[model samples]
Target chain A: MKEFLVISGKGGTGKTSITAGFAALAGDIVLADCDVDAANLHMLLEPVTYHTEEFIGSRKATIDPTHCSNCRLCQESCRFNAITSTEIACTVNPLSCEGCGVCSFVCPKGAITMHDHVSGHWFLSDTRYGPLVHARLGIAEENSGKLVAKVREQAQRIAQEKDVEYILVDGPPGTGCPVISSISGVDLALIVTEPTIAGLHDLERVRQLAGHFDVPVMVCINKYDLDEAYTRKIELYCQKQQIELAGRIPFDRNVVSALVRGIPAVAYAAPSTSENSAAKAIGDVWQAVRNRLLA
Target chain B: MLITIASGKGGTGKTTVAVNLALTLKELLPVVLLDCDVEEPNVHLFLQPVVNESEKVMTTVPKIDGNKCDGCGKCSEFCAFNAIAIVKGKPITFPELCHSCRGCTLVCPTGAITETPRQIGLVEKGTWSVIKTAKGTLKIGSPLAPMVVDAVRNTAPLHHGDQAVIIDASPGTSCAVVAAAKDTDFCLLVTEPTPFGLNDLTLAVELAKKLGLPHGVVINRAGLGDHSVYDYCHEADIPILMEIPFDTKYAACYARGGRLVEEFPDLSDRFLKLWDVIQHHAKRHQREEPKT
Candidate 1:
């Protein structure tokens, strides 16, 4: 099976819009949104969840008031400063806690207990296009990268079971742990970037990140007409790096309008619509990706 | 005084506020600017610091001695990050996943586990612009940014009576950001007015609370997104340090490699006054309770 992953260097770079187009165009694929922290792919796919499971990424320490006196050893042991001093109760700061469980081991009062907090939830669902795997990491929860990896693994397993030929994965922005988990073992990576200085700069960073894993990547300029000079610069970068430039879409208001309407630009504004130019440009991008992957 | 500019979301003008503030301070005193966005640091592009010297920084990696090799998966079992995996007879380690905590070597019963050096990235130093603002650039592949931040802090120029050190940190309240603001006296978080911006700014504020770093806010593209950011600041009792409007000309100059202090000469006096306010607040905060 030929798998394709899409990622962007920064937010609002039109990665989801283009990924939605590929989902609408591709057939018989397991679609997934690896950007669990800020996932919006479900807005377009309209995936009807068939399976849902709570994801407990890490353990949290809770003080059992009935257990014993507040010896304060657990509070002293917590490097995260999670334990409250005035309340006389040791509570884990959801954002501060790293799930190290050191407090449990260090508690002399034996009042501290570890509990599995439902950090987030993962979903396996049926979308209009096909089966979709999406997830939502809870507020102030750590281990987003791990949750992303789990969801991707589930998607890959489902794709393998059904003998699906493609897994269109919508990866996260940035070159952090989550992005690394998303791009690993993917056949092709579509790095969507803008035609701006920071756009090109972060593009090179993520591109190098993908290169470290030896993953083949292609470039897609989302707002090419915004800055022709930077777009040409990105093209040169792709050529110099031997990475293919898939295609470019001129800046259009219809793209955002289509998003607010909850539909892929290509389907909502195909060849016969006012957004025909933008839709056709996306078609050309898919054509290039197809020739690069299927050929 | 040490001031750090940070944000939770990217492209929210962390570097812009940082470089501009640093330049504005340069007119007041000797300024040192450290870019802690090691993942994909673009501050250098704006600061354009000339490379005075370069040094390679490395992280501790596990070294397996083949002669002392016992193919036991003890190290793999002890790894919390799933970095160490024993496939068949050979043990494999993913560098990106390793947190360099040396847990594997501690758990390995056999003498096979040893410390080895792995160069994650570089910490290069020079001066930013003609004003000689000290700066650093972290390469892309190097994941050990916190280490570099610590290193920079160790060697960071002091405030020197009247001078102040301003740090431009990476987005997100991760270990890297913590490392960047380790010993900072105060911090200013730059953010736009958006849902993502608010979410991240609140998270960053929580981080500052944990770290006990007195901080304020700098609202970039202030009027574009929403006023909820203002409401959030008021509710949290955090001061709005500075506000840069959604001026297309300013953004265009920033995009075209024009320094804000250079374009808006009036900003220099404003930033100087900002420094005075920060100094007063930091002093008042520190003096709130005298240490016995």
Candidate 2:
């Protein structure tokens, strides 16, 4: 199966929206919503989960106060500064802990113990478009990158089991761990950006990251008319970088309207409905992506 | 006061709100803007801060001493991150996977393991207009954004009672956002009025509540979606601090990195008013928090 990921280094650049559009257009696809922290593609796909697994992505250190000694060794040894001396005993701040197990290992009293942290849950579900593998990381949870990796692995497994041709992934914002997990090893990464300086800046970072992973990339500028000057700048950047420009999608209120209706813009506003709708532009972008992916 | 601008969803104007709020507050106080979104630090683009200082944020990775002669597998077995593994009777380390816990060094029976600093990101400090700005940029392929965020947060004297530090946190309620929200006096959760925005706003609110932060909401693009976001705030007792109406002209201006307060001076009053509400709620919450 060919895995195609839609990512934007910056948030809110229409990664999920565009990925959902691809889901609607692609044949024999397994959708993977790797934006586990703030997953929005499930809202559009209407997934009815058939399988769910609790993801123990990492471990958290906890202190057994009954056997504790006030040596402060765990506090000093901790690189994360997650351990602190409370009035009663030394405590582990769950949020600050990186679950490295050093505190547990170095504790003189053996008071600190490492336990599996139920960081998130991944789901295998049936959607109108196809099968979807998505996840929801617990609130204020760490290890989102691991959860994303789990989702991708499960999606790829399902794709292989069902002989699916394409794995369309909706990635999170930022070039952080989760973005890396989602975009790395993909057959193609379609970076969704906008005609803003912020967009251009973040696009460079994402492009560099894609290059770091040796992942092939194509750029698609959303809201191309918002700033024609910056749009030209982005076009120039693409030209200089030798990256393919898939297409430019116009800013359309209908996209949000479609989102409110819980449907893809292409499905909500068919290409035949209007000559210059965002839906038409999306269809063209998909065709471009498909042609390149199949090539 | 330390105020964090964050959102659960991306592209909801966290940087816009942060930059403009700092610029507006700079007129009345010494304001600092720290962009903690290391993976994609965008505030620097809009602020145009001429960075005068740069510091490398480093984490320790094991440096194996091959001459120590014995390749006991104990270090590999003791590593929690699987960053070290016994390869060809030797311990091989993957620095990217290391959490800098120093566990492997302690577990090495042959005393072959040592620690070395690896740069994961960079912290840049500079000034833009009257605002002191600092930002963190993670090395392209590194995953240690939270570490960089902590470094950026420490670049300024955040404890000055008379100073205002505005932190533009990364989107989503994850580790990076958690690092930015730490020790903040208040959090301004920015969101738009849409299903996706509301869905993620609820998550961001949950994170704020979990952190026990005094937070309020700013509704950007108020006229774009529906009343669900407003209803969520009303139901949750989150004060709606400010509202920037949906205007294409403002959006276009922002696209070119134009400051709202500079392009339209009338908006400064709105941000100032936003500060007023934030001050009122933040102080009230602070006073009540001590008792809890």
Candidate 3:
């Protein structure tokens, strides 16, 4: 199956909306929302969960006060500064811990032990369009990249079992761990960007990341009419980079209106008059992406 | 006071709020603006700071000495990240997977492992119109954003007791956001009015609460969506500090890299007022806190 990912290096650039629009158009494709930290695609698809799994992200070092050895070794050896030692005991800050086992290894008293922390939950659900694999990372939790990988693995498994032709993934913003995990091993990465300096700057960064991973990339400029000059600049950059420019979606109020109604633009827009709407532009983008995938 | 501009969802004007607020606060006091969104930092794009110093952010990965050692597999067994594996009595390392914890080096029985610095990103120190600015830029494929963020946060000048440190955090309530918002005097959670925005804003608020930060909301694109966000803030008892309505003109100006406070003189006064409200809320929050 072809793995298709919709991502924006910058957040709130209509990545999920566009991904949901593709879901509305491409029936029965395996869907994965890899933005575990702040997943929003599920709001549009309204998936009914069929399977759920607890995500044990990483191990955090904990000290047993009963052992009574406050040698301060764990506190000093922890590179993350997650441990704070008082005269009576040492405590680990869950938010600060990177889950590296150095503290446990360095403890002379063997008081520190590494325990697996359940950071989040992933779900396999049936949406109106297909089976969706999504997750919710715990508040202020670490290892979002690992959770993203879990979501993609489950989505790929479901796709393989059902013999689906495509797996559409809604990726997170920023060129960070989660975005890297989402784009890794994907067949095509459609970067959704906007017409702004921030958009262009972040697009360049994420595009470089995709290139670093040797992933084929296509560009879709959302809110292309917001700044015509920046749009032209982006088009020129894409041309210079030899990257394919898939489609340009104009600034459309219907996009937000559909979002406010908790539905995909393709589903909410009137079919008869959607020729010039954001929904239509998304359909064109989907077609372009599909053609590229098949090619 | 250290104030962080953050959002659960991206593109909700974290950088916009941070830059404008820094500019506004600079008029009253010394301000230091930190772009802690290392993954896709955009405050530099908005402020266009002249970088005075650029320092490489490094993480150490274990380098195994093959000639001096027998592969005991202890390092592999002790590694939490599974970055090292012993195959046929030879230990192999994956640098990308390594967390640079130095556990493997300590666990090696043969004393054949040493640390090597790997460049993950860079932290740039600069000045933007009297605002001391710093930003971190993670390498293209690097995933160690929190380390870069920490470096940027550390780059702030010491002895600025009266200056306001404004941190522009990346979206999502994950480790990176926490690294930016943690220990800040206050957090400004920016959001829109849509259901998606509300859903993510709730998570962001939970993060702020968990961090014990006094937070207020800044509603961007106020008229674009529904009232669910307002209801959420009201139900949660969180104050709405500012609202920038959904206007094409404002968006167009922002798209062209124009500061809202500069292009629209009225917004300057609004941001100034917003700062006063934040200071008051922070003070009241401190007063209401129970003794530790």
Candidate 4:
């Protein structure tokens, strides 16, 4: 199967908006939302989860007060400074803990025990587009990278079972663990960037990340007209890098309206002149990703 | 004095404020604006530092010796981060999942698990003469940002009791933020006044409290949302240092790689005073600590 992943180096770069549009155009494909930290693609997909799984992340060391010993050794051993002693009871701040387990080992009384923490939930769902796999995490919870891997696994299985020709994935922003998991073994990465300096800056960063994994990358400039001069600069950068400059999307209010309406450009405003720019942009990106990845 | 500009939510303009502040503050004091947001380091584009120096940031990971293995699976059981997993009589290493804790090494009976250093990223330091901002860039695809931030901060030229050091941190209250905020004198959390901003700001504030750092807010896009954040600040007795208006022209300048304070250097007086208020809070908090 041919796979195409859309990603932004940072948040709010129109990755989902363009991904959902491609989902409308894609046929016989399994959709995956790999942005497990803030998987808002499901908000647009509205997928009904057919299967769910629990993902246990790192564990925190808890001090048992009933152990009848208050040795401050555990407190001192923790480099994270998670454990603090007061007049009454010793406390381990969950937020401060890195789950290093150094405190648990140092406790002579064995009072400090590590307990599994529920990081988040992964789901295999059916959306209008096709079988969709996604996940959601608790606030300030770790282990999003694992959750993203699970989502991709389910999507690949669904695609194989149905003999689908395509597997569309919406990758997370940034070069974090989740992005690493998403980009690994991917056929091609469609990097959605903006025209601003920050956007171009992050584009270079994410491009470097994709380069490490040997993944083919294509760029789509969102709101290119917002800064035409910067847009030109970005074009020059892409040319210098020898990476394809897939498409340029002009600033349009309809993109926001389409998002609020909970439908993609192809579905919500198909044949509408307002979405012509974005529609062309999506098509160009899809074609570039396919040309570079598919045999 | 190292001031870290941080926000809990993504894209609340942490880099914009950091770059501009570094640009503006350089005139008042020698500044080093280290971009601790390794996941998406963007300050390099704005400042375009020359990268006079670069260094690898290494973190320790456990390496198990098969000949010395005891098949106890104790290392796996002892690992809190689940970075080590015993599958089919062999321990698998997940480097990205690893937190660089030496617990597995300490617990190995035969000393099979030993600490090994892996280069996760690089710290690039240079001077931007245009904005007069001395900056550091944390390389991408590297999970260890705090390492770069530490390297940048600990490098020579630290103007103790003199020049101020400002770090632009990654979004969210994660390990990276903790690393950046660990030794800072005070923090300035730039946030919006929206519900998402308020929720994440509360988390960041809790982080500040837990870290024992005095902090105030710079509410950007102040009029866009309700002042519940302001109300919360009042109730918590925290100071609102400054409120940047929702100006598209400012956003345009930011988009064009233009410095807001450069166009209008008068804004530096207000920012510096904001830092003064933070200093005031630090003095007050230090005074409140009981005599040891």
DockQ metric for all predictions: 0.18, 0.86, 0.86, 0.33
Candidate 3, overall lDDT? Answer: 0.90
Off by over 4 Å in 2: A270-272
List, residue by residue over B138-160, the lDDT tens digit for candidate 3.
Answer: 88888878889999999776665
Task: Tell me which of candidates 1 and 2 scores higher on DockQ.
Answer: 2
Model 4 vs. true fold: TM: 0.78
The 10 consecutive residues of candidate 4 chain A with the worst lDDT sum are A267-276
Residue by residue across A53-172, what tens digits does model 4's lDDT show? 887766887988887277788777776667898766578988667777888887888888888878778888888988888886555555566777788888888889899988899987
Q: Per-residue lDDT of B110-137 in model 4, one digit per residue for the tens?
A: 8888888887766666777733233335
Candidate 1, which CAPRI tier? incorrect
| Clashes by residue pair, model 2 | A12-B10
Error of 3 at B109 (Å): 0.6
- Cα lDDT of candidate 1 equals 0.74
Runs in model 1 lying further than 4 Å from the true structure: A10-12, A20-30, A36-144, A158-165, A253-283, B129-145, B157-163, B181-187, B193-219, B222-243, B264-292
What is the TM-score (0 to 1) of candidate 1? 0.77
Tens-digit lDDT track for model 3 on A57-146? 988778899883888888888889998988898989888888888887888788888888999999989988999999999999988899
| Model 1: per-residue Cα lDDT at residue B95 | 73
Clashing pairs in 1: B120-B142
Model 4 misses residue A146 by how many Å?
1.9
For every candidate, the chain B TM-score is 0.90, 0.97, 0.97, 0.86
